[model samples]
Target: MWIVLLLPIVAYIFIQIAFCRVKSQSKYLRNVPGKRPFLIFGNLLDFLPGSIVFLDNLMGYLKTYGDTILFHDGSFSWILLSIDYEFNEFLYSSSVHIEKSDQYQFFHGWFGQGLLTSSGSTWRNHRKVITHSFHFSILLQFIDVFDSVGDNLVKKLESEAGKDSVEISQLISLYALDVICEAAMGVKIQALEAGNSEYVKSIKEMCNIVVDRVFSFISPRLYKLTWTYYREKTALKVRGFVLA
Candidate 1:
């Protein structure tokens, strides 16, 4: 009973320390410009509307802050946004700065620690292994797959050509998926032809869940209590959806 009572106190103390640490880190970036953060939520509220709105807001920030801005999701997450060529070159051309940002944690469930999510020596090794897969000659071999997929996409657009309005985004996503599966995995999932297939729908749903999770302000530990988490868990069970 006493331990339970002390739990809140312990948690509060831990949070205070973490908050203080974040504050100290921010002091170095004080000269960096960004929208003033809110209490606890930090700059996350600015990005909650959706990707389009977030991109609009980000473009405004770029105009106002002149790139190389600093912001954080919460006290524990400090992010540096830089678009300067020299800064980007320095970061990408060096092995010392190979760590990904906190946002990539959301991809852990879907991609595990593969190329997109891994870092340090693991990332280096993965990059080495996959380097040949993207070589010009290797990519040229997939031209047939691309040509077939492009033909399908053209036919899809042609069918929707005189419509009042058509949502081509979903069609394009399916097109890309079909290409990736055929070229990379050596399997034809036919995502465009079978748009409503369980494989295609599960992939789309998983993407939606991941995007939502990235913008969500809730604690990940509490994710199990939400429907989205359960849905994501179920989607991961889709057979033949090999995750790297």
Candidate 2:
């Protein structure tokens, strides 16, 4: 009796997989040669976890294949990826395609309607206003800010000179972050001196959380079910820092 019951369930699983495989191959995308997708998983099984490896996987795929490749997530959504530099440059710079990708809207919760995520006229208006800030004369004002951050970094490196080689990547990243905060935000965070800042910790956490959601097989909104409490907590911390 146990064998009889298990046989039907096993058969059902195979049937579902077959159905999903068939459905995954779209009429338009069928022309592109790529990996076969699985039910509710798509090509997710083929990717390494986290944002960094996920991007590497794409570049690897592009290298293995040609410029155009088909990619899918779960059952419903499909992406026609293009690696051709000229084609992508035209797509990005063309006035007609001003809207950011669907994934960008997820960042709206953290960044608000600023340049990277905003769309339509709001983005155009912000672009116009912020473009002037990049003028040569205006940018010349930030030289002092760069010098200040660079001087502190040199002093920090000199202090650690005789010791074993330090990870300059993190140290320089912290310094660059401090420069951006001072120059762009007009706030002197002095993040290098602060060492472990609550804002820095929270923002880093927020970025990782966002990257996970972006690559998730399911909808990004679904992350709220698991991370709502944590998301709110971090958002409050970021808002507190910005508001202050």
Candidate 3:
């Protein structure tokens, strides 16, 4: 039993070492210079728990590797192209070559095939419809709608400020939600007024949960199988409330 367990463990270690060596060797073959990626985990382990550290690590890599760097996340490889005039021009010059990556399929559950997530001809058609709907004259007609929402937000904040130094971040978020609901759906959520309004609470909780799931190593398919009571139930309720 001891021999059997030890043999498997040893073999696993050997395989991991070999994979690391092969990945490291590939750096030499490539035209650019980059830090050799670690085996299996790659550079992901360095920033596994949070994005702040991940961003810091990426900045450090940028300092060392210059603007353009190649890195691997799990089995997925990507090129980090820092912003430059030439790169911006190349990106905006053509819609044909600037298609969404295959990795975006993972977000299907969150956004469905909506305009933000859709691509190719479907995206083009959606863009045309939205553009026509928001023509200059149409937008100009909504000036009162915009002004009313802004005034409501300023009044709400003035009332809240009398109590104590408000948590500006939370207040701003609630204000934004109220504004969007009134502007887009023609529904007043009044999230800023109620403070603990169910819709506002649910939206914030859902956003936090989604962010947590995205940063984790959990399989994207697993999110499809599992539904949190907070997100699913609240989403259904909110949708009904909004549509009503």
Q: Which runs in model 1 stand beyond 4 Å of their true positions?
A: 1-8, 49-52, 83-86, 239-244
- Worst lDDT run of 10 residues, candidate 3, spans 74-83
> What are the per-residue Cα lDDT tens digits for candidate 1 across 1-244?
9999999999999888978888798888899888888888888877773556888887887889886887776637778889999989998888788889777878888778988898988999999998888778888888999999999999988998999999888899889989998887888888888878888878778888877876676668898899988898888787445643
lDDT of 3 by residue, 175-235 (tens): 7787778777888877877888877776766665654553454566565566653465455
Question: Model 2: clashing residue pairs?
Answer: none
What are the lDDT figures for the candidates, one per model? 0.83, 0.75, 0.66
Candidates 2 and 3 compared by TM-score, better number? 2
The full ranking of all candidates by TM-score, starting with the best, is 1, 2, 3
Q: Which stretches of candidate 3 lie over 4 Å from their true place?
A: 1-36, 49-71, 75-93, 160-166, 225-237
Best by lDDT: 1
TM-score, every prediction: 0.86, 0.75, 0.67
The clash tally of candidate 2 reads: 0
lDDT of 3 at 235: 57
Which candidate achieves the best TM-score against the true structure? 1
